[model samples]
Target: MAEEFRLRSVAVAVYGPAALFGLAEGAMLPVVALSAIDRGATTPVAALIGALLGIGALATNIPAGILATRVGERKSMLLAAAVSAVGLVLCLVNIGTGPGALVLYGAGVLLIGAASAVYSLARQSYLTESVPLHMRARALSTLGGTMRVGLFLGPFAGAAVMQFWGQSGAYYLSLAAVLAAGVVVYRVPDLETTAEHRAAAAAITTWGMIKRKWRVYATLGVGILLLSGIRQTRQTVVPLWAAHLGLSPTASSLIYGFAGAIDALVFYPAGKVMDRHGRRWVAVPSAFVLGASFVLMPLTHGAVLLAVVAMVMGFGNGVGSGIVMTLGADVSPAVGRPTHIGVWNELADVGSGLGPLLLAGVTALAGLGFGIVVSGLVGFAAAGALWTWIPRPSRGLRPAAVRGPPP
Candidate 1:
């Protein structure tokens, strides 16, 4: 058996920037929507600006992967941070400038989204190459854990900055974080220059990689896509559900915050479980539990019950913290892993964008409760798909079923 992988300086180097980047992202996410509204956008338009973040990410996912191949992971990450910093500056400058301020804001948000896509794909690709199969789950999940911590901490930090300096201050905070992240990435060794990574980069074009692994991409990718959609829907519907309940804003924030903490706390254990048993062990339960939470959302009318459901959702989400990325790593050929990951991430981005839109449409036609139920249905459907599709690698040879390069 491969010796147990230990955390190394390199791993820390990769994760540090990701965590900082996520912190900046968390600070900006809430502020951007509010800023758009302040600049005179309608509620729907403001929401669209938020949605554009995911949409812009989706547009760039493929190219980002390819760029990593050409420029190397470290450089790609540095570029991403730099681009995001520029975007943040634009966001601050355009705030309340004029009638075109909202448009400028949307453009800035879109640039940040694209930069984020570049950073995520590059980092995930690096982890897949650097970590061994036996310990891939733990390593990647820890990556998720770091980001969750940032997400949990960022809002409070942003709120503190805004309290003194206003919305533009939050943007400035994000810019500072991104710049710091760039510095961290700059100091890391050029790990992506290893022969194996280089061969993988040269093995096939991104399009060629897709053609070779079309089946895995089509089947497992679709399942993960649904899971991604369900995940995003939970984020959206849960807040709406709280509003529907007429719960105090403070109470709602606390519930979500508590649930987020639950989600972050479980990531390490979830990774351990996946590594010890198999991906399905966590994947199946996560989908079912989260799906059940959505179904239970409308049935409960009180604050306590709503919180319970929310916690359940958090538990489900936590268990699958890095699952989608882990699964991508398992199936992708090491040599061309980055290219395949790009495709995988694109599906996830699609799902993220699709979920809110689906909920909005369903809620518009039916009711909010039913819209949530529809999300629940998607979750259950994803569970069924994952159970059938995730390959069962032999105990002696973890990740074995997915080892060979794509045809």
Candidate 2:
């Protein structure tokens, strides 16, 4: 009973901040391109500007890991929250439309992305050090689920505020959310760690740790890359296809919300499956279903049909919640775990950035539908990669070095 109580407390501490942070991100993300356009950027320039978020995150992942390793998770989180607040404040700046405005907004978005990398690494590190091996997947999945729930609700909240305050309202909402998250994190006590563990983690360089785990990175890392690519590509596929089918923006948003609702509902169950059966069970099915959905996406011509496909895509995504983080935790060493997770996150982010590029190139060569179909093929490849690479758990198999003590 005491163990359960501790687990619950940890959950409240970690997941609350995550949900709030996710809400801020969700509210802010949709307005990025629009904000750019409003600030005098061309359509293409606006798209590129919006992409700075991912670029900034990719650039900072390793550094975030290093920082977390040295300063501890709580401090890292606090620093990240401060940076995110600054970013939101920048977003709120209202200069007349020009290069000056664009530069400020772009810088803000970049800062938010960089801060997110730190916050995410810290949170994942915290959970990895707090939960026992048996409950790792469930805890991580619940973490993912809470973030998804926040994301689902955030846009509506943004819209509600937008009715009164316009695009700037979203930024205000995000700013408030991030600040609240920081407060929640501040109120929680840091996880207890031995001096030896801290010294050991601090001694190992991130590169050295990667060298030691090269095989794991080469094998499972590639699988994670492909999976992330497919998942990210799904975001583009739906809206692009909806536009192709002449669906209105309102219709597209509704379909997206419907799908997101489904996506947010399945994380806990997915985690349970991973804990009970294995990671492969959820990972394989998720990739397969997502692939199948993409393959069928081009065939849909109406809102109803597209909504149905979107729901399937959502379900596919929902089932794979926390799979990446759980896999990272499973493979990370107790020593320098933050750095290992940072590398893992970098790989996934690279894949995410690449997916849309691949889609764009393919579409330029062939057609939108063909490009989407190609992405679906990539999904199948992801499934195969995960199936081949993920370790098969046996009855005698013990958790890897990253697992913490029992609560």
Candidate 3:
């Protein structure tokens, strides 16, 4: 598997466009928040703009899976890019048009979210069929790492663009990057397909796939849901906790940025470990560490302790970069790969959407401290579930025709 993990031309072609699309998305994140604020939205309303991205993705996930089955990964990505370009244009056009601007901006961003779902699901499905089983983890993990790199760099680039041209100008960066990604998708040679792949895709309706994989979806998939939810909660709760402790916004932002750096640094190595060892090596520890971070949130008093905890949480998240997607790829049937992964991704979105809501509800009923603690407990429980539920690929499960596309 290690030997087979070499980066060939086709892999490069796929990854290249994906990285560009990620760069565009990363650059757009902060801009959307600021743009909404500038459009006369209150602070909470502006925050909702950021939240809409996830909401839109959640709404589109299942449908995107169906679209992928009909049109295939390459075409789906191309369509996504085109739609995203239109969304970016709308955001740019509505730039400072008063309170009504948010409506336009939100709509555009929502459309972009749908496009992202399609692009992501299609690419994941394509990789599942294109890469060998043994090398799959590394390839998918590398894919995750590449997007992180783009995300890391995107803000800096967007900030520079905003500095000169204002926040609205940042949309142009996204627009251009998206177009470039589209070009790559258009020019690159498509991965070869098989009759089984087509038949499986065609036969597997979204609802049918859900019914067929209900057991896995309900069990191991729940672990993934909790994992994703907990991960998102950390992002929201950490900042809220910082505010509760009277940490200045600047200090908190700096701490989070540093932690994100730590997360980005570990991607390739994490992939390597997952491949050589097994999923449990990273999965269980990540769950424990993340859960502990949340539980320990109230225990941190000063800035330094908070920073340390943030770094630990980042490390936990970093190591688990592609775990959800990798596990989804490992378990999905080759015939209806996109549908299975789509449902998996949709479950993930449910977790992500529910996380902040759960924290907010918990905080209102109890205290923020208790809410954090509850989240941590969920993480610990999820860790337990993942360890017990996720099946380990057999030592004898080497690359074979049985693992490949149907003849």
Candidate 4:
């Protein structure tokens, strides 16, 4: 039998670094946006914080994947942690309020995003190798949930630090978290593929793997891009609009916290539904639910309505994210694991990055309602693609599809 604590142990060790980075990120939203406003950032400049971060992260994923394949999983995680640490510390420098602030914020988010993509690809691949297939989805759900616990706590931590320490102090505290993350990344055990496997893969570059698994990889990548775009708008633009409507920081954070909480709660049930039913069946309507939730954003005027939306959106995202990770892990062979995951994440990461920029643009041009509606349509298209463009069976994931809607 696998060691009882194996996944949990590794997860715990890395959990702090993952969670700490989030706490720092939590501070980032308020500090970045409000600070930009203070410095007179136009809507596009304000939105660029996310755009730049995406750009930075997009630059690193392929390289990180290459390194992870050559060096080992644990080592890549370490590098990611260390890079994130330095970037967060640099963010403490206050870099003016307009473009400078956006640049600094982008750099920090980019480092975090790039490292996180590698960190996650490695971790998920390792988990797939380590665990039984029957337990795989649950494992992904639990492990993913473990990190969200940190995210749930992080915004509050950021808000608290910002409340007392001011924005600079908040970044400083976030810097500390990055340092802690680096330590954990360095300590996690190496998960290198065996020499025999490496030798077999020697003939196959990362590009080779992508060329081989283009269909499944493309489907997952495209799906993730669409889903992530929707989420980015929800997280970045919607909050700013709500805040503009005079919502308190604490209330906003709490709403996010609630989403994170409900996300974890709903993950497994959604997974079982996906497993028992069809990917398209599970994905299409859930996409509709997700789209409808955003389209209804304008109708939300209070904590209760916000909470309701949060739960619905969170549940949809939890299911979708869990399915994709598990599906990617399922498709990625042990020989070229990082390559498969890199492509998988690269698409989603870029889409997520573009999302805030697009939403911010819409908000600048029209209003939050236009952005929300556009995002909804994007998600709806993704869902429709599942019915039309995506192939009949998702490779290596879920057993035979069950007939009905999820339980």
Candidate 5:
């Protein structure tokens, strides 16, 4: 009963903050380009400015990890939330349209991104330490699910606020959400840490930790990168193909939302399957389904066919919600775990950035359909890589079956 209580408490602590932070992120993301344009940025420049969030997150990943290691997860989360709040406040600043305003807005977005990196790493690390190995996937998957729920709800919230206050309202919503997240995080109790764990963590630098796990990083890391790339490509392919079919923006958004709804529904089940069976069960099928969907995308000539394909893509994505974090946790040592997770996040981000670039290049050289096909091929490759690398359960080792609550 005590164990169950602890588990539930941890859920409230960890998942609550995650959902709030995700809500902030979701509410703000859609309005970024619009805000940039309002600040007098050209179309291309606005797009570039919009990308600052990801760029900042990508750059801060490792540093965030190091900070988590030093300050511990809860404190790191609180600090990140504070920084995110500052960023959101900056976004609310109205300096009028010009280079100065654009630069200020970009800086605010960048800070938010950086804070996001820290918060994400901190939460994942906290869960990793708190949950037992057997329950890790479920815990992580639920974490992912909560974030999805927040993201799905965020746009609607933003839209509602915008009705009265315009695009800037989204920034206000984000600020409130992030501040709420910080308060939740601040109230959460810290997990108990062993002297041994602390000593071990303190002994190694992030670089040394990476060196020690180079083999895992090199092999499974490649698979993770490919998985991320394919996922990002899925996002791009759906909208572009909808455009190709000459679907109205409303039709395209409906299709995308349909897929997103499916995506949001599957995380818990996926995690349950992973904990009961193994990572491969969910990982292999997810990549395979995504790859197959992308491969089949070119053949869809109408909105109905495309929506079907998009739904399949969503299922593929949904099932693998926490696969990356789960895999990273599975392989991470108690020592330097934050650093390991940071590196893992970095690789995933790189893949995300690359996937779109690859699609664009291929589209430029060949065609959109071909570019999506290539991305599909990458998915197949990811499946193969994961299959080859993800460790199989030892004989008769059904961790979930034997579990009460993980020790």
Candidate 6:
């Protein structure tokens, strides 16, 4: 356990830059939506900024998988970070009025998406190599937690720069963050690919490997789909819910940010439990906490009540969201890790993108409480599935299982 802790620490250090890049990846976009509107984009046009970013990410996923396989995950990641840095710099073009601004925004997002995909692949592959299978969950939890931390900080950083120096200042800060992250990555030691991995220069050409493992992936997809929906509801619908019950936007944002901060602090430790006790110990409790939070969130009308709900939600998110990434990394075949992880990340995003839409309908028809309860139920179901059939250490790699790496 001590040795595993040491190794996981090193892995976390390697991922430090990764966390910064991730912060920049998610932080600015939502705020950027506001910027776009200020720059004269219509509400639909402003919303399009976020939609375009998602679409761009979806488009690049396949290509990034191919690139990671051909170029090596390390190289792919470094390039991804560098390109993203450049894209962040391009945010200086705040299309204040015309379609030209929209075009530039689109281009910047496309580049950002391309870079993010490659960056994520490299980080996943790197952690896979650095951490033993037993400790991998904890390591990934730390990394994911960093990303959540970045979420906490990125908006503030962007907003601060914008407040003082304006939008140009914010973009410049974004560039600096990406560049700093890229520099750290470039300074790191090289990650070697296995011979089997080296020989494969293409994206997954044959479906056989993935098809055979369909059960695992399918189960994961369903489970995370639930998690993603929860995340979406929290992001898009929570504010409205708060308003219905009289919570301020500032208070709402704090609730959201606090959850992320708690996740950052708790994920690694929780992951250690996952490594030692078993996934169920973490997965089951995480779901219950999250589900209870959702069921109670709509009912809470005061700050004190909301704070309790947020803390519960954060702890549960740390377990489910952060832990899920680690498990996905574990299940993938080493040779196709980048591509496999890419698909997993994208599937997670499926819930992320669609979750808001589902919440919208729920809020429209049933009300905020209905949406919260349904979303929480989805999380509960996901946890239940993991508990019942996620192939405990009895079948997969855990203390009881042998030392062979996950395929």
Model 6: what TM-score?
A: 0.89
lDDT of 1: 0.84
lDDT of each: 0.84, 0.89, 0.82, 0.65, 0.88, 0.69
Which regions in candidate 1 have their CA more than 4 angstroms from the true location?
1-6, 192-200, 395-407
Clashes of 3: 0
List model 4 lDDT by residue over 1-407, tens digit each: 33355445545554455556566565564566555555557776666654555666677767766776777666767777777677666555565666666666556666766766666766666566555555555666656665665566665677677777776666677677767777776665555345886666455676887889888756666776787777666666446646765788878877776777777566556656654564565567667778887777767888778777877888777666455666666566656667777777777777787776777687779987787778778778767665664444444444321111111
Query: lDDT of candidate 3 vs native?
Result: 0.82
lDDT of 2 by residue, 1-407 (tens): 53484366677678999999989998988899999999999999998889888988999999999999888898899999999999989989969799999999999999999999999999998887887677788889989899999989898899899999999999999999999989988877777678898898898887898889899889999999999999999888888999999999999989998999999999999998998898999999999999999999988989999999999999999999999999988888767889999999999999898888889999999999999999998889989999998877764235554433334
lDDT of 6 by residue, 1-407 (tens): 63554354454345678667766765576567776776678988888776766676666765676677778666777788788876776666764667787777667766887787677766766666666666767777777777777767877787777788866666777687787787776666665445664675364642644675678768866776666667656655456666776778888888767766776677777888878887778777886777777888877878777777887787777766466676676577756666776777777777777777776778789977897788777777867776765556666743222122222
CA shift of 68, model 6, Å: 1.4
The TM-score of predicted model 5 comes to 0.95
Q: How far out, in Å, is residue 311 in model 6?
A: 1.9
In model 2, which regions exceed 4 Å deviation?
395-407
For model 1, name the residue pairs that clash: 200-335
Tens digit of per-residue lDDT, candidate 3, span 199-256:
7679878888888989889889989988988988887877888899999999988888
71-187 per-residue lDDT for model 5 (tens digits): 788899999999999888888897999999998999999999999999999999888777767678998999998999899889889999999998988988999999999899878
Question: Cα lDDT of model 2 overall?
Answer: 0.89
Q: Report clash pairs, candidate 2.
A: none
TM-score of each predicted structure versus truth: 0.93, 0.96, 0.93, 0.80, 0.95, 0.89
Residue-level lDDT of model 1, residues 255-372, one tens digit each, is 8988898988999899999999999999989999989999999998978999889999999999899999999888877566678889999998888878878998999999999999
Candidate achieving the largest TM-score: 2
Which has the greatest lDDT?
A: 2
